[model samples]
Target: MSPVFAALKERHPNLRPQFYMSDCADAFWNSWRAVFEVEGVTRLYCIWHVWRAWNAHIMKVVDDARRSQLREMLLKLTQASTPHAFYSLYNTYAEIMNSKEYMLKDQNKKPRSLANTSQKNMSSTTVANCGLVSAAWAQISLPTCT
Candidate 1:
């Protein structure tokens, strides 16, 4: 265990550790997974980084109106409490993008289409950690005695 955890455990013996890691290269994830596996620590990718990646994708969209609409939907998807709700919003966005009514082009001025399976290939991380820390952090009344 790290010294930080040791100190915190001294005060709160029942505390549990939840590790949040950004999705990294295969080699880095392999090494990290091995170490954390032995320690029995649960790990998840930070949702903040996931949201940033989504924003980057939105910026690549050529049409201002479509970009704004997608951004709005992205915010709602991130805020969804259940996986069903998230996917519902995601599918809605995908349908709009793929529809003939919503003619769109890429930043390169070439025509583009939204592929249903393409989103899976765009990011390295799938599982996102959103509420893992917030509730715990709110309850901790740590003294900033340093």
Candidate 2:
């Protein structure tokens, strides 16, 4: 990957991407950063992968209706047209996760907060990267690459 990036740079000295999207892989990110260290590149994770990971957590919701609501909220967060909308939806989702209304029972029948479970499964870095991707998309109108 570094060699390929180096070749591209060799061919086009002015080539600098404003955004680079990947599947949230550590190797890809490390390579990208190594190649574009001084460039202001907004790293983005694939939205499909992000949604798939979050869906696993959403499926754990015991209440069907609440689960559906959470699914919709997550979808909205990913599909938000603007950074402001994304942030708003993200806050609402976080609030719901932290609230007592979103609870699951342990084997002992004691309630456990979904917030803890979610935070355990999904790191804050993933959420922050998603926001960066959303913001980059909102600010640019780049042609889609195959």
What are the root-mean-square deviations of the candidates from the true structure over C-alphas? 14.6, 12.2
lDDT, candidate 1, 6-60, per-residue tens: 5655677665455434442234335544433426443433444445545665565
lDDT of 2 at 13: 78
Query: In TM-score terms, which candidate is top?
Result: 2
Clashes within 3 Å, all models in order: 0, 0
Task: Count residue pairs with overlapping backbones in model 2.
Answer: 0
lDDT of model 1 at residue 8? Answer: 55
- Show the lowest summed lDDT stretch of 10 residues, model 2: 107-116
The TM-score values for the models, in the order shown, are 0.45, 0.58
Q: Where in model 1 is the C-alpha error above 4 Å?
A: 1-19, 23-28, 38-43, 100-146
What's the lDDT for residue 67 in model 2?
72
